[model samples]
Target: MINQIYRLVSPGRFEITYRDMSLNGNKLVVRPKYLSVCAADQRYYQGRREASILQKKLPMALIHEGIGEVVFDPTNEFEIGQAVVMVPNTPTESDEVVEENYLPSSNFRSSGYDGFTQDYVFLNRDRVVPLFTELNNHTASFLELVSVSIHAIRRFKEKTHKRKETLGIWGDGNLGYITALLLRKMYPESTIVVFGKNDYKLDYFTFVDKKVLINDIPQDLNIDHAFECVGGRGSESAVDQIINCINPMGSVSLLGVSEEPIEVNTRLVLEKGLTLFGSSRSGTVDFQDAVNFLQQNKEVIDYLSQLVTNVIDVYSIKDIDSAFEEDLVSSWGKTVMEWKI
Candidate 1:
């Protein structure tokens, strides 16, 4: 099979590359239906990463968050024309305790190799999770990210103490919004507070119990657990604030990604007896859990739909560039490309 892959050969440039793939393998071929732009994709597109890193990662297909339709299933597991969310993490080794996403031997798409920008994505037998018709395709496109949130929450539940009275989510971005929303649904009795610098962005989280400006948090306020969704330079302050406001022996889930190491108040963390756990890309299990969660909670689809900022149709390489450019300037939400290319 000859597949056409749209790759980012350089900053602000994409090129069409060809690969002859074998269809006789155990893998199934899925035609990407919808793809979502993530913050990491923007960093690669705008060359925000270190020159050496960019040099190593460029000339690679650019999107890991996407849903596709099964075109060819040599494994005979998935039905032809089935709509599924593609899992991005590919693991080479199995561990007894460690998850696939945390395994160092795992290969995640859009990181080093090709992603879903290809004409047809060849995925492992377990890498595709079927989506129900009730879930919107636009919201389903970023199921990779939603799976990450599920992974983090699952880890948090395992590591944290029994008490989840007050949950604090820092940063009002998409991750924070999704995490807080999930927590609200999962822990209906708990008070969820979202802390951020932007009122406008924080306003988007209307469902949360409370919204507090980072600088204006009440001194007496304290949370049983916290999630730092603010990545980049903001991660430092967000974690610091969590250390300060979280109750003693509380748990903090680190879902944010930072390019460089940031200083943490280790003394405070130790003194407070805090357990900080970090989660990143998720595996097939998390993807399946996310699928079940969406199927069970049909209302979540309506809430997630608010995050779709743009749904551009891409029929050519030029449309891909335009979608990335448009996503770069958008103040909030996810940008999805209806993949017709």
Candidate 2:
């Protein structure tokens, strides 16, 4: 079969090309139903990444956050028309101590190879996760991101100091919102405080114990732990503030992607006895846990639904560009694409 794939040949340029797909002994074949635009995807589309990195990663399919329907499954692991979330992390080798995502051999879709932008996606059974029928397509499309948050929180729980009375999350973006929400759900007794610059965006986080402006934080305010979701140019300030406000022996989970290297207050970190950890792409287990978390916590679904600001349907290559363009201008919320092709 010839698969119609949309590839980013260069910055601000895309092309549709056909490639032969061999279905020999393939367990599952999925057709994308909905796709979500992530900040990383936008960076690739707009050439925000370093030129050297783009030169090696371009001309590849660009979306890793997507939901699809099973078109064919030889083993009948999933129903023919069942909905499933595509797992982008492909691990060829694994170690007992190191997780799949941390493995150097893991090939992440949309990073080094083709993603789910093709007309049909062929996968091994483990690469696709089954989703509940009631889950909305828009929410399911971004399950990858949710799974990433889940993974980060899991790491925090395993490595952080036992004191969990107050948790501070820095950044008012979508990632910050999701991390705060998950923290509340996972640790109901702990107070979750969000720190960010945008008043309008911070307003949506009413479920948190407190939302404080980064510039206006009270000197007396302190947190037992902190998660730094602020990446990019603002990361230095966020990390410094976290270091100052967090309690001694506190742990910091870093989730945001920094385009360029930023300086950290290593002296403060050492003096405070802080343990800092970074979480990147997630694996199959994290994906499953994310779906189960959503299914068990029905109310979280309603809260997450608020993150969908723009829903655009993509019927052609031009629509793909338009969705990326609109996502660039949207101040808050996630831009989801209803895959029509």
Candidate 3:
């Protein structure tokens, strides 16, 4: 089948191209319903990545976080017109002990391969997770990001931390908000504190135990564990603060994406006995868990609804450009694309 795909041909440039989508056996064809723009996607769209990396990764589709409707299922697994979240992490090789996302051979969408920016998407039966019909497209579009936070928390639980009473999350962006919110739901007994630079963004985190400005953090304040949700140049300072404020033997989950290497305070990390772990794109199980979590937690769903600040309907290539431009300047919340094409 020939499908129309929107690809990033160059920095700040997109081209709609035609491609042959081979409908192999045992695969499902899905039509993208809603797509969410991620920071990683923005990095590619704006050519913020390193020149070498951009040269290699350009001419690829630019969306991995999306929900789609089943258009065709040859095996009769998913019902026609069912809403499902497409899993972008495609593993070419697997190990008994290693997860699919951790495998070196895994091919992630929107990174080196074409993403969901096509008229039709073909996936293995296992790559899609069904969603409730009532879920809003804005919320469903960002399920991939929520699953990443859930995946990080799952990894955090495996650590042997001396304490998990107080959790400090640095960065007031969407990732920070989602991670803090997920932590609050997963461990109600634990106190969650958010640290960020923007007052307006921090204001939305009212459910947390406390919100502190990164500049105004008290010298004596400390946490049992920390999550560095700030990436890029800001990650260096975020990591520093996490190391300085986290208690000894604390676990820190790193969820940020940085194009360049940043320095870490290894001296402080060793002195504090901090265990830092990094989490990237999630897998099929994480997506399922995230969907189930949203289904069971109505209150969380309500709070998350506020994160949808901008929703643009994409009917043409110009609309796609407008969405990216709007997201680039938006101060807070997620900008979701309602895929009409």
lDDT of 3 by residue, 227-280 (tens): 999998899889888888988988888988876788889998888777888998
Model 2 residue 325 distance off true place after TM-score fit, in angstroms: 0.8
Clashing pairs in 1: none
What TM value does model 3 have?
A: 0.98
Model 3 poorest ten-residue lDDT run: 156-165
Tens-place lDDT per residue, model 1, 181-265, is 9999999999999999899998788889999999998999999999999999999999999999999999999999999899999
Candidate 3's error at 198, in angstroms? 0.9
lDDT of each: 0.93, 0.92, 0.91
lDDT of 3 at 30: 96
Tens-place lDDT per residue, model 2, 1-341, is 89999999988789999998878795699999999999988888999888889999888998999999999988877889999999999899879999999999989998978988889998879998899977888988999989999999999989987889999999999999999999999999999999999999999998999999999999999999999998888898999899999999999999888877888899989998999999998999999999999999988998999999999999999999999999999999899999997
lDDT of 2 at 21: 81
Residue 114, candidate 1: C-alpha displacement in angstroms: 0.7
In TM-score terms, candidate 2 sits at: 0.98
Task: Tell me how candidate 2 scores on lDDT.
Answer: 0.92
